[model samples]
Target: MIVSGVILLALVAVGGYGLLSGTDSEMAPVHRDPAPSSTASPRPETPSRPQVPRILPTSNPETFARRVAAALFTWDTGAGLMPLDYTSAILDVGDPSGTEQAGLAADIATYLPSREAWVQLRQYATTQYLTIDNIAVPDAWSEAVAQAQPGQLPPGAIAYTIDGVRHRDGIWNDVPQVLTAPVAFTVFLACPPDGDPCYLLRLSQLGSPLR
Candidate 1:
């Protein structure tokens, strides 16, 4: 199915730190460096390990979608959560298998920054809001499923649109600033033949707003 021109509104909190402001078309993911700090202190002797977010697995697609969206958009530099840790947390929630897991790892490697960068910047997402507009199967996925073995095919596939706002405190002034954008992605779900359970099969970005 062609999922276009569909829209929805959802207001989600970012672990009680920030608020989502508007509804509109998809935007590119935003990455901004924190302004230079006026008061600089010696770097910590020992960097703390990142605290990964809790993963609450669920069979419901919509709920899982929301979780994935939030995980992809949120981060905490102050708490020592690095980009790799963030990626690991997201993977834990999805529980992908085999090649899917490998693909996710590769994607994370390509997109996430190095540990040194995280340590130097100390900038992380304070808040994020994801507005899931539509869920539908893409034609290419449908055809692929049709040609595949019954059990090999994903139970469901959906393309969803989400808008988000990432917040961070300005480095020099200590003022808060927000980076707003929208994103779209296609997700594939793996469901058991029996009455077992469901998990994320694969996720791929469809489009994003221009920076």
Candidate 2:
């Protein structure tokens, strides 16, 4: 994990606040009238389900970060995974909550190629692999902590480099090629003091021409 307990404690000591101090709201209950008929109606035909890609589990924050990076870099149009599906997979791996996940979903949809575009490029079906180079606390996180008021701690963030490549079908293409040079990415994560798993708060490519 990028944010170890000792570092988190040091950060809190400097900021004069704990990481998990936010309040949570209770959901309101909904009431509905009893059904008019106890008997069930005829069932409708079930629609075919979309083929969603598998999501791997991560044991810690660093593993989760790597998984998120890999998910963002890899896609397969021929496997019936669309842009939305890809983003959904990332959301699953990150395990974010509230409107944050919705915002990320929208951002990813806008950033990646559209379904139609992917279909058009199906002939060159490519699979991308991402290798994590390093993970460290980003300067932005430190700056935010320094500027935060008492009783407020900055959100945790980790910066990591990824080397990516696109492998095309050998028969369709002469040889596989690197998509672009190694790129760095910064991912913001919510670190609760209660020892719960950290969730991704935001993601951005750092000076990477690809995507």
Candidate 3:
């Protein structure tokens, strides 16, 4: 498991933050009035569900890291999508060897809204995306790399810590509401020196990325 392997690196904390903070508080209860279909004008059609954006193949570590970060944050509740729908997008770009897939799935579950929360948030037509402030390889990661024994790490493995703000928007009682919060996390991946594309390995706990 990737969690066990990452423990050897001593790279990150054990678990992620609690559920996306303030999601429920920011959302208002569903309104209970009914507009008669005959008296009410036709409601605008909901937009078609978007295609899940998968992480693109890339040999550049920073480029791949940024894509992973964005995939982790960008989501919509009103698009006829669920949290698992978003999860699948990231898993599509996960470690192809399947070694870390289970750990990766658990890590991802922490960063997204829960299924029950998803159903509630849908009432508000909520959406979210990240605005990255910075991305870099942390000093601790370099030290860990130097300390690693031969065969301890994968060929071309690297880590990038991302700092950003998570911005969420939703309609509440006929008014649009927006919330912004700072976020940080690390992405572990490998781009083999032999010209293969990068593949996601694991994610550090949310709010506890390596320095």
By lDDT, the best candidate is 3
Candidate 2 C-alpha lDDT tens digits along 37-109? 7885544454445566554653366666666666666655456456777777667745344535654565455
In order of appearance, the predictions have TM-scores of 0.58, 0.59, 0.80
- Candidate 3 — worst ten consecutive residues by lDDT sum? 20-29
User: Which residue segments of model 1 deviate by more than 4 Å?
Assistant: 1-50, 94-97, 109-117, 123-141, 147-151, 154-172, 193-195, 206-211
Off by over 4 Å in 2: 1-59, 93-96, 149-180, 206-211
Candidate 3 C-alpha lDDT tens digits along 1-211: 4444443344343554333322322322343345557688644454445688778888999999999999999988766667899899999988888988887888898888889888777777778999999999988888767766666668898999999999888777767888888998889888999989998888888887877
The count of backbone overlaps in candidate 3 is 0
Of the pair 1 and 2, which is ahead by TM-score? Answer: 2
lDDT digits (tens) for residues 127-196 of candidate 1: 3335555544444544454555544444453333334433333232344555554455544455444534
The true-versus-predicted C-alpha distance at residue 129 of model 2, in Å, is: 1.9
Q: Give the candidate number with the greatest TM-score.
A: 3
What do the candidate models score in CA lDDT, each in turn? 0.46, 0.48, 0.78
Where is model 3 more than 4 Å wrong at Cα? Answer: 5-50
What clash pairs does model 1 have? 27-182, 27-209, 28-209
Give each prediction's root-mean-square deviation over alpha carbons. 12.6, 14.5, 6.5
Clashes of 1: 3
Alpha-carbon lDDT of model 2: 0.48
